[model samples]
Target chain A: MTKEELKIKIEDILPAATFDETGEWLNILIEAKAWYGFAKQIRSSRELEFDYLFCLTCIDWKTHLTMVYHFTSTYRRHTIVIKSKLDRNNPEIESVAAIWRTAEFHEREVYELFGVKFLNHPDMRKLLLTDDWSGGFPLRKDFEDPINMIRL
Target chain B: MIEEVGTTTEGDLIINIGPQHPSTHGVLHLVITLNGETIKNVEPHLGYIHRSIEKMCESLTYRQFIYVTSRMDYLSAHINNHGCALCVEKGLQIEVPPRAQVIRVLMDELTRLASHQLWWGAMGMDVGALTPFFHAFREREMINEIMEETCGARLTMNYMVPGGVMFDLHPNFQHRVKKFIEFFKSKIDEYHELLTGNMIFVNRMKGVGFLSKEDAISYGCTGPTARGSGVICDIRKLYPYEVYSQISFEEVIETGGDCLSRYLVRMEEMRQSLSIIEQLIDNIPEGDFQAKTKAVLKLPKGEFYSRVETARGEFGVYIISEGGTTPYRIKFRSPGFSNLSALNHMAKRSKIGDLIAIMGTLDLVIPDIDR
Candidate 1:
């Protein structure tokens, strides 16, 4: 199925979700409260299995954080992009690591780098960063490290 | 003396297999808890070669970041470059010309063949078969030469650009590729004669490191590692990219899920990749080599995810753009991460000697894992 068809199908299921057609895959922006339920439905729905949670990551957008989940159904050969806006101060969400096993490490990575908490994650430890990393959320737009400087 | 000899209790022997050892391959330290000859547990300690490629990509322009990915999986550098280029193209909404797509496919297949050749040699050496190492390297050298002639550097050839390739196919590309294929075909019989049918090699690998299909999928193993367990999860076949849709090839699958099965699958995959290159070499398409795009690329404020089938398995590059030349965020979903996850599951019931063979068959390149 094309990105347009996937978008329409997702919108039909969850009316409140917003979408951006500019990116490569179909990007559907969902409210934080609706994310968990929509994810479960998407997984169990026969029309869209989305069995593979290939990539799950978080982007810190200065003002707020955006949680991105890249889903693909091996059976249906379709791709969907799910995003949820999170409060920049204390981002938290229910972990989907239980549903798709591949999300275990990815969720932990998001938790560490963006300071987003995966509520039920089995093991949420620092993945790529060190224990003494004092730089707050390195990927955020506002982050600055004088130790690691750059030339303009 | 009698008490010491007869009344002794057996304790597990702990052995550090790497972080510097030759067989561990690239700064990987495997702490093996052994009960005599049997392995009780194998714990992998990583992060030695972590250069923070993802973190580095945030600072580089979209064009410059492709070179950084080349360093991740150094063996299949062309495939890595192809993947990053494809993601950038997707992000920028650029359409590559048909000829460029075909050339990309050709380079990808050659990279696959070269990677499998190195795997074959290294795997054989891991299982105490040394001669196949030279044989494998002999064939791999041809591929390296071909890559160097076109892309300049052998291992980390950043040949792929966003709109198209760095350059068109070399004038002698077709001729050299055809020669390599014929040469590889003639050497296939020698591979079988020397190693595949050898009695000693079979005994060492057969029935070792068995992973059931259910465990393989649940753990998210991919590439030949998962295919060895009868899982048909080839990203090239399932999610056709570039010119893979145009060509026909078999996804080699074996049900044994042992060291021998993994070995045979990689061998068969090498043959299939050669077949693909043979089919693509003669029919060079005539068109523009690259797509037209702006000098400075500005991706719309959003997220883009691209999954390409690497030599390992499903390799994903997720890019988040915030209307800037440099990506706001980039994440690499490496195949080795999942493949490495299955190691403890596969090695729990195996012997110490079999651990090397198991690790070999998984084909875990440490930099890719640490990245």
Candidate 2:
């Protein structure tokens, strides 16, 4: 489907959705509270079976955190991006691990680096960091590693 | 301190496979729960080599960060840099010249061939045959010499920049690549004779660590690993970057999801890579290699992502730029991380020796996973 058709289809499902088509793929911005249902529709809708969760990450914007997901359909051969903004103080979102298994690892990585908790995630522990680490989320803009003196 | 498996009896054994095991190909720690040579679970402990590359890239400029990715998957360093360069170019809206695109495709295919050669050798060695390692490197050295002569680095050649390549091809780039392709074509037959038809190697690999098509997709497997299970996840075909759209090559697929299927998929992939290189090497157009760009690049405030089919799988570069010379946030979707995530699923109920066969076909490079 064309990007314009995708925008219309998504608008029908969630009228509050906004799109940014400046980049190559179509980016849909949705509310954090509505993400779980919206993601399920995106996967189950016959026209848009985004079966592959190719990339999942978090962007720390100081005031808030944005969770980004890139998906592609092997059958339809179309790609789309989904973004949801979360409160920076304590970010939490529903986990899609049950829907797409790839989200299990990607969510764990984001959990350790950005401190975004994935609700309902089976095994929620540090996947790439030592268990004893007590520093704040390193990917956050305000994170300061006094021991390493690493700040951006 | 270990968590017991479900309904465990008195004699269940849990073993540590190596944060420094030689067969792992890198520093990958696998905690295996064994019930007398049958694996119940295989959990991978990463971060031993986690350099926090995403955190580090926030501090480097657009041009400087490309080299950091070279260390992620050192085996497919060229493809890793290419993905980052493509993302930067996409953000800045720079159109690379046609000549540079062709050269990039050529280099990428050569890199794939080199990576497969190493995997083929190491896979044999992992299965207890040592001679294939020497034979595999003998062919790989030719490709490395060709890369060194042109890109000026052996493994981590930071040859790609935002707009185009770092430098134009060397004077003998075409000659050397052609020679290497011809030499490799002849050696491929020898490779098949030495390992592919060997009864012991076939017996060890076939029907070991079977991952069905549905499972491969659910686990996010890509490249030959996914293709071995009859899933068409080849990024070159799915989302063509560079001149790949114009090239004609088959996405090698096998119905058998065993280690042998994965092994044959990679073996056929090497042949396909040779064909791709042969098609592009002769027709490299003569034009400006690098497009002219500003002294400093500042991407508009937006998100840009690009993916390349690396030797192991699909490697993606996602950049969030806030109209600055440096990215506000950068995330590398390395294939090893997702591929490694499926090790537990693949290794379950397999013997201790079969784990080596499974990992060998997976062809993991742990730095990529940790990064």
Candidate 3:
């Protein structure tokens, strides 16, 4: 399906979602609360069985955190990107671990690096960072490390 | 969706198999919870050698970032660098010259073949066969020699730049690659004799690691790990970049979804890589190897993603540029990371020895996973 078709299909499922059409893939901006429902729908829906969650990441805009998800159907090969904005001070979003198992790992990586709380995530722990890591979220724009002595 | 098992309970025996164990390979720490001899849960405690390449890439220029990726999946360094280059080129909206495209593809296939050869040798060593390791390295040494001549370094050559490969092919690159392919082609049959048809080796791998087609997809397994279950997850075939669409090769798939099937798929893929090298070795177009671009590359404000089939699986480079010289945020979706996520599922209910066999087939590289 073309990006137009994917946009229409996704619009039907997510009413509040807005899309940015400039990128290569169809990009949808949705609310953080709506992510779980949309995730379940896309994974199981007949027209959009986005069974593969290839890349899940969180971007720090300093003021707000934007969660990004890149999904591609195994059979159809059509890809889509979903973005949800979360308040950087209290960044929290529903985990899609139950929907796509691969999100479990990516979510953990993001949780530690970006300091985003993945609510209902199975194993929400520091993945690439150590448990005793005292430095704040390394990926955050405001994060500082006395060890590296680098300040942004 | 919580961890199925990994928590220690009463009367459970657990063992730590390396942050440095030789069998686990390359600083991978696996915490195995056991019930007598049978495995209960295999929990991987990572971050041992994590250098945070993604965090570092945010500070480096687009050209400087590609070299750092070589350290992530060192075995498939060329392909990983190729993926990053393609992403940056996509952002810049420039086409690589035909000569450079062919050279990049040739280097990619050579790297894959060399990487698979090392995996074959190391995998054999992991599973109690020592002689095949030496046999596999004997041919890999030839590929390294070619890479050393052309790229000027062995592993992690840092050969690929943004627009194209940093340098043109060496004077004897074709002759040496052709000779190596001809020599390796004859030894393919001997590989079967030494390991493929050996019953002891066959029995050790045949049905031990059973990952179902659904589980393979759910776990986001790619390359031979997914193709072993009859999934066509080859990025070269699915989303061909460069001159792959022009190339003729079959993406090898095996339906068994066992350790043997995954092993067989790589063995078959090595032959396919050779065929690809054979096809392109003679037909490298005569043109400017590098496309003209500014010395300082600043990707336009947009999100660009490019995925290339590395030796292990799909290595994707996701870049979000804010119209700056450095990427705002860069993520390297190394294949071993997702493949490692599925280890617990595959290792459960199996013996401790089978863990090695399963891991051997998965071909986990520590830096790739940790990155």
Candidate 4:
């Protein structure tokens, strides 16, 4: 399916979801509270059984955090971009690691780099970063470290 | 602390496999917790060659970043360059000239051949066969000469650029490639004679490191690793990019899902790549090499993800842009990462020697894993 048709279909299914159609992919912004249910529906629904959660990462927008999930269906050969906003103060979201096994490592990486907590993550410990890392979320725009010279 | 230490009896021998061992291949130190040759657990300690390329890409222009990716998987540098060029082209929405696309495909095929040759040799050495190593390098040297003449670098060519390739095909590219093909055709039988049909090689690989199809998918194993398990996950076929849609080549699937099967898949894949190169060599079109684009590339606020079938598996690049020259967030979904994930699953029940064979069949370049 084309990005336009996918965007319209998503909006029809989830009326409250915001759509960004400018990019190469069909980006649908959803509320944090609805992320888990939306992910489950997207995975199992006949129209969009996005069985492949290929790439998952978090962006530190300073004021808020955005969790991006890049989904593609092997059977349908269609792609969808799902985004959910988290409060910058205490970023947290339901883990989709259970839905897509590939999400496990990516989520751990996001948790450590962006400080976005996965609510039901089985093992949310640091995957790449060290245990001694005490600086506030490294990827955040506001994150400043004299030691690392990280000035965004 | 003393009481806790007493309570926590060291049940297994903790052995550090390498930070500098020849077999581990580039500073990969595997902390194996073993119970009498049976691996209870394997903790891979990485970051020895972490040059922070992703972070460094923030400072480099789109053209310069192509060279950085070369270092990630040095053996398959052409594939990596193809990936980054495709991403930048997608961002710019520029169409590559037909000649450039054909050249890109040819380079990619040669790179695949070179990569598999190195793997064939290294994997043979890993299994304690040294003669095949020299034989494989003998063929690989021809491909290296072809790359060096055109791209100016043998290992990290950095030949590919956004919109198209760095330069037009060298005068001797076709001649050298054709000569290599003819040479490879005559030498192909040597591989079967020396390695594939050998009794020792078969025994070492046949039943070792068995990974079932379901487990292969769950762990995200790709390329030859997943293909060995009968999984059809070739990115070139699924998402046809470049002139790949116009070409005909087998996906090369095997059902054995063992070390031997993986070895067979790569060997077959090399032949398939060679055939693709042969068909496309003389049909090179005449046109501009690179499409016009602005000096500074600022990808609008959006996200782009590209997946390419690398020598080992699917190499994915995820870039998040915030209307800036530098990417907001960049992540590489390396094929080696998932392949490495299956190690504990594949190596747990095997002996120490079989463990080395399993690792070799996986064809891991440690920097790719750590990145």
Candidate 5:
């Protein structure tokens, strides 16, 4: 499907969805409150069935956090990038693990490094970090570790 | 504390396998819950070698960061570096020369062949066949020699630069690759006779570690892992980059959706990689190896993502540039990471001995997962 047709179809399902066309794929920016609802709709929607969640990650912008979810339908073969803005101080977003099983690992990695809490995630503990780790979110912009991390 | 570690309310046995186990091949830990011989749950404990490459990339410039990627999936090092370079090229809007494009593709295929060869040997070893390991390495050594001659490194050949390759190919590159292909082709049948047709191997692999098509897609498994389940998730065919669109190679798939099917996918993939190398080994275009660019590279403010079919699966490089020398944020979507996620789902209700075969087929590289 062409990007134009996808935009038109996505518009019907998500009226409040803001589109960013500057990048490669059709980028959609939605609020954190609307992420799970929109994700569920797209997964079940007849035309825009975003069944495959290929990549899921969080970008810490220091002041706020942005969750990037790259989705594509295995059958339709078109790709889209969906983003949700979260307040960095208390970053929380609905977990899509139940919908896309791959999100279980990706979300857990994001949870530990960025300190973003995943709501209703089946397994919500540290993934790549050790149990004794107390270092503040290593991927955050303001993360400081004088001894371990080499600062440039 | 020791007693509490193993026994649950229902009297299930908990077995801890390697941060150093031979079967694991790298630093991967799994705490498996077992009831008699069947596995109830498999919980993976990672982070033993987590260097946080993403955070490290935030500090390095566009040129410096691409080299560090080879350390992640060292098996598919060239492909990982190529993916990173592709992302930077996308952001910079640089057109790689036709010759460089062909060279890059050839290197990618060779690397894929080498990676699969190593995986083949290791998979055999994991499944308790030791002789196949030596035979597999014999073919892989030729590719390593070619890599060392042309790229100056065998494993982590950081040969890819943003615009194109760091330098032109070696004088004997084509001749050596052709020689390796001919040598590998003759030994192909022998490999089948040795391992693929063995009666013990067949019984151990067939109908074990079953992964359904639905579950495979949901877990985001890619490369042979997903193609084994008949999902048609080959990034080379789905989203062709470089000279891949021009090449005529099959996206090998097997419908078994078991350990045997996954094994067949990689075995066939090695042949496809050879056909690709054969097609382009002599057809390399005559032109500049790299495009003209400034020494100090800078990317405009935007987001760029590039995907390449690595030996394990889809290796993606996502770069968020803030109009600076360094990338604001970078994320590598390693194929092994996603493929490893589906391990527990496939291994449930399977015997403990079958776990090795399942992991062998999955081809989990711990560094790629923990990176």
Candidate 6:
């Protein structure tokens, strides 16, 4: 299906979701509250079975965190990007790992690097970093580290 | 490393295999929970070699960042660089010349052949046959020489730039590739005879590491790993980039969903790569190899994504450019990371020896997974 067809179908399911038309793929901006439900539909719906969660990442925009999801339908061969904004102070959102198994590891990576809490993530722990790592979310815009460390 | 290799809950023996074993391949630490001989869980501890490439790319410009990807999938380095260049090109709206397109496809297939050769040899060694390891590298060394001749590098060839390739093909590029194809084509039968048909090897691989189609998709497996399960996840056929659409090649699917199936998929893929190179070796178009672009490349503020089918699987480069020389955010959807996540699912209930067969067929380069 084309982007326009998919856009209309998404609009039918989500009336309040807005879209940004500047990017290559169809960009849908949905609220954090509606994200979990809309994402479930995005995967299970017949017309838009976005079974493949190719990329799930968070962009630290300083003031807020924008969660970006890149989804592709293995059957339909169409792709869409879903972006949701969360509060900078307490960034938390419903986890989609249950819907897409690929999201499990991805969500863990985001949680450790971006410090964005993925609600109900089965094993929410440090993935690439050690448990004793005290550096404040290395991928965040404000993260800083000294040039040389005296202690390991 | 196995400080505690004792019986866990319900008499399952928990054993940790290498953050440094030869067969595990590149710093992958698999903590397997075993009940006698069958595996109950395989938890992989990654990031030992993780240089935080994504964190590093945030500071580098679009042009310089492509080389970092070469280090990720070192075996399929050319294809990794191609995916990044394709993403940057999409954002810049630069049209790559037909000659460069053909050359890019040619180099990609060559890299795939080299990677599969190494996998075949290494996998054979993993399954207790050391002879094929020597035989596999014999063919691969030729391809490495071809790459060195043109790209001036053996393994990590950052031959591709944003608009086009860094330089034109060497004077003997076509001839060398043609000779290599002919030489390698004759060796494929010997490969089947030496390893593929061996009952001992077949017994170890067949019916081991079974991953169903539904599980393959759920785990987001791509490339030959997913294709081994009869999943049509080939980016070349599904979303053809560059001259892949122009070329005629099979997707190469196997429904076995076992170690043997994944093994056969890559083995057949080597033959397919030879066929692809044979078709394009004689017909490279005459044109500028690299397109003209400004010294400083600044992609307009937008999000662009490009995916290429590497030897392992689909490598997607997602770039969010805020109208700057350096990318605002760059995320590489590496294939090995997701494929490795499904290792536990594939290895469950399988014997300890079968775990080696499963990991071998997956053909993982540890740095790729770590990145």
Ten residues in sequence with the least summed lDDT for candidate 5 chain A: A143-152
Q: Write the per-residue lDDT of candidate 3 for residues B1-371, one digit (tens) a residue.
A: 12444445677777888888877779988878889889888888889988878888888998899988999999999999999999999999888999999999999999999999988988888888999999999999999999999999999999888888899889999999989988999888898899888888998998898999888888889989999988889999999999999999999999999999999999999999999999999999998888999989999998999999999998999999999999999988889999999999998998899999999999889999998
Candidate 6 per-residue lDDT, tens place, B1-371, comes to 24568986588889888888988988998889988898989988888888778878888888899999999999999999999999989988899999999999999999999999999999999999999999999999999999999999999999999989999999998988888887888899999999999999999998999998888998999988999999999889888888888888898999989989998999899988999999898899999999999899999987888999999998989888789988888888899999998999899988898889899999999899888
* Estimated TM-score for each candidate: 0.88, 0.96, 0.97, 0.91, 0.98, 0.97
| Local accuracy of candidate 2 as per-residue lDDT tens digits, B197-220 | 999999999999999888888788
Q: Model 3, stretches more than 4 Å misplaced?
A: A149-152, B1-9
**Cand. 4 Cα-lDDT:** 0.82
Q: Considering only the true interface residues, what is the Cα RMSD of candidate 2 after superposition?
A: 1.9
lDDT tens digits, residue span B257-329, model 1: 9989988898888888888888888887998888888888887776666778889888888887888999888
Per-candidate local distance difference test: 0.82, 0.90, 0.90, 0.82, 0.91, 0.90
In terms of lDDT, the poorest run of 10 residues in model 3 chain A is A143-152
Question: lDDT, candidate 1, residue B107?
Answer: 87
The stretch of ten residues in a row with the least summed lDDT in candidate 4 chain A is: A143-152
For model 2 the local lDDT of residue A34 reads: 92
Return the lDDT, model 2, position B166.
89
Any runs in candidate 1 off by more than 4 Å, and if so which?
A1-47, A131-136, A145-152, B1-15, B32-41
Q: Which ten residues in a row have the lowest lDDT in candidate 3 chain B?
A: B1-10
Segments in model 4 whose C-alpha atoms lie over 4 Å from true places: A1-17, A37-41, A44-47, A135-137, A142-152, B1-10
**Native-referenced TM-scores of chain A, all candidate models:** 0.88, 0.94, 0.95, 0.91, 0.96, 0.95
Model 4 docking tier (incorrect/acceptable/medium/high): acceptable
Model 4 chain B lowest lDDT segment of ten: B1-10
Order of the predicted models by DockQ, top scorer first: 5, 2, 3, 6, 4, 1
- The residue pairs that clash in candidate 2, if any, are none
Which residue pairs show backbone clashes in model 5?
none
